[model samples]
Structure formats: C-alpha cells, structure tokens
Target: MTPRTPLAAAHAAPLDLGGRTALVTGAAGGIGRACALRLAAAGAKVRAVDRDREGLEALAGQTDGVEPYVLDLTDLDAAEAAAAGADVLVNNAGIQLVRPIEEFPPDVFHTVLTVMLEAPFRLIRGALPHMYEQGWGRIVNVSSVHGLRASAYKSAYVAAKHGLEGLSKTAALEGAPHGVTSNCVNPAYVRTPLVEKQIADQAATHGIPEERVVSEVLLRDSALKRLIEPAEVAEAVAYLCTAQASFMTGTSLSLDGGWTAH
Candidate 1:
C-alpha cells in the first residue's frame, strides 16, 4: 500500500490568516513575493518590504492585501523597527556575489553580512517584544542550501547563511516559551531573477560558458535536475505558519531536491 503523503491526505483545516499581519522581506520578487501573495490570499495583511520600489509597486498591484515598505535592510535599526507588531515574519532578503575569498571586495562582503544576517537579527529583535506580549508569532528565515553546505567562490554568501542558521536555532529556543516559532526554509537554486543573474556570475567565476552553468555547476550536487519554483518554496513557508506546524520549530525544511540526503 502506498503511504499517504501531505498532499494526498485531505486537509482538515484550511489556512486562515484573518486578523493576522505578516511581514515579508524581499517581498518584491521570487520566493518572498510568492509568500507575500500567498499569505495575503490566506487573509493576512502583508507588509511587503523591499529595497526595490518599482518591484514593490508592481507586486502590490497584483495582490489584494500586500502593501509595500521600501527600505534597504542595511539600515539595521530601521529594519528592526519595521518588524514591530507582526504576527508572522518571513526574513527572506539576501544578496550574493560569486568570487574567491581573496578576490571578494571587503565592502560587498560586509554588505552581504549586514543584509542577510544582521538585519534578520534586528528584525527578530524588534518583533519579539510584541510577540512575547501577544503570546504568538512566527519567524521564517529564508535560508539557502548554502547555509548547510559550502561551495567554492561564494565566501560572503556562505558565511552569512551559515551564521543565519545558528541565529534561527537560537531564536527558536528563546521564543519557544512565548509561542514564537523560528525556523529556516532552505532551498537550492530556485528559479528567480537572482538565480538568473547568478548563472552569468557563476559561469565567469567557474570559468565555464554561460550555457553550461546550470548543468555543470548549479545542479551538480542536486539529485533533481530542474530548479525549484518560487511558489513551491512559498508553500513550504506557508505550511510553517499553519496550526499543524506549531510544534515544528527550530528545524530546517530543505527544498533542495535531495541534495542534503547525499
């Protein structure tokens, strides 16, 4: 007999976010955009934060409950303050550069750490007081496969992601008693504009032609050949906020096509 999967079984309760507010960083596009739309569809009033104002406007036009908050995450105090009064917080903003550690620009490296790691910390800090007061909150960190495994030519990204993993776990432990759950959703090579840009950067960094980057470099470790969809990653993020997932905190849910299983 085939075992019943999550999709195979009928859901006893549908996701309902009425009276909830969700804050999604990087909500201008990719998985973050999908998450913002999904949560809005579930009746959450979504505060969609992004550095790109144009992208945010376009995204806001397509969704009913998503509103844009335009700010660069490098402003740590602003980032933290922006997260106050949120019931669900999806920390999904990040940037990447493909270069050897010696060749990596110091400024770029610092920016990556600030955006990916420190900003999330500050945002969580800003969010916790309200969550602890209310006795409920969700923190979903959009980590990457890079967080769990190292790759050559991406020193800043790998370092920042690894640090994020530690922070997510620490937050989980501290927030547990207060009904705040912190977890990471780690996906590999999702189809997004960021990845489209990385294809060229990886090609140049790995010294391979652009045409062969997907096959030779990006999917080399992945058991699945194709890239994950943004919506699929959003579904994972959505699941984490459901009542069924209340006990599932401090763990990483990997969408890496079995890359970690190896």
Candidate 2:
C-alpha cells in the first residue's frame, strides 16, 4: 500500500461530527476501523460493530468514544436490529472468494449475496425509520471498482457489489425526501487483511508468484501503481458525513486510480 499522501498533511477545515451516533460495521480492522477512529476523532460516539470479539476489544482499547458491538451480519434480523437509531451508518463488511463461475460453490455464493447484499438491505430498512424521523442521516456504502466493472473468477463478489450499487441508488431516491443521503465510495484495492490474504489465492489463480501479484495482477487496470490506504478511504467517508456533502447523494465517489476512466 502507498503511504499517506503528503497532500493530506496540509491543514484544512476540520470535520466535526459532534453528538452524532455513527455505526460502522466490520469495525475490527481495515477501512472500517479507520472510519470508526476518524469519526471518533471528530467527536461522534461511534458504535464499532463486528464479529471479531478480540478485535473489537482491541478497538475499544485504542479509542475513547467507541462502543463495540459484536454480532454476525449473516443474522439479518439481528443485523437490522443493531442499526436502530444510528445517525450515520457505514456498511463496510464484506467477504470475497475468487473462482471460475462453474467451479464456485453454490452455498458460498448464497452466503456472499446474503452478507453483502441482503444484509445491507435489512440494515438500511432498520436505519431508515430513525433517519427519516430525525430528517437527517448519512449512508456510506463501501463499494468497489468491481461494483462498476467485471473481472473473471470473482462472480459472487462482483454480483454482490453490483447489487449493492443498485441498492445504494434506490436508497438515495427514497432517502431524498426524508433528509437522508445515501452514496457509495468505490475504492480500488486497499491494504487490508482480507486483500492481503487474497494475494496468494490471486497468484495461484493467475499462475503468478505472490510478488508479481501486486504489480501485474492487482495494478493491471489501475493507473496509480500503489494500493490505497484504509485511512484514505476513511477520509472520503468522513467527507460525506460533513455538511459540505449534504447535497451529494445517490451517486458514487470513485477512488479507483482511474480504473473506470477507461
């Protein structure tokens, strides 16, 4: 992953999320964790939701304003229930598996759609009443370049993300009348445990060494050579929650390193 851009070091107006209750899924690590911390830094009381007990505990230890909520998103009802009364929602939990469509397991495909697509629907369902009632809310879906484009051997992930893109746009339309803004930040590959673990699998699937996977496979379509940092993704999420972005919804912010520019 590339180091934090020097441009970000320049001082700018600070985002203040004071008094807001932000809920971040998959908050145990990576982009989710960075978002939780960033929101906390901005004075929001962040509810860090994740299935990883140890990771959540660690996150709580590192931050003063975070409350860790441990729950599996697969339990859609529980997932929905957990989003109750949240002022800001970051839907960031996801799982990926790469294989030829013919060889992909049926059960895994269902799980992917369930976790990535259906769960977001339920979470939004649960969150909407509160958001609508308050006449203010933010929904940031952590989509990907895959959501807008296709790559072989990632049918389930691509399909789930594509469905999520549709869901996000629909929510934006419905949310418009209710003072809620829904949008997606579509980032390219990021440096996360999930992506790190996939390196070997990608190498194996593409018939390349692990060392070559980063340069040749991952960056093949990217104009920028380095993987995005989780904090960079978090910064984009933070910007959406600010008043400056109140008018921006039902759209996508691409952090794809020009992948979709083609």
Per-candidate RMSD, Å: 4.3, 6.5
lDDT of 2 by residue, 1-262 (tens): 9776355344446788899899999999999999999999999999899999999999999989999999999999999999999999999999989899999999999999998899999999999999999999999999999999999999999999999999999999999999999999999999999898778889889898988999988888999999999999999999998877777999999999999998
| TM-score winner | 1
Local accuracy of candidate 1 as per-residue lDDT tens digits, 2-76: 865565234547788899999999999998999999999999999999999999999999978988999999999
- Listed in order, each prediction's TM-score against the native is 0.95, 0.94
In model 1, the worst 10-residue window by lDDT is 3-12
Worst 10 residues of 2 by lDDT: 4-13
Q: List the residue pairs that clash in candidate 2.
A: none
lDDT of each: 0.94, 0.93
lDDT of candidate model 1 versus the reference? 0.94
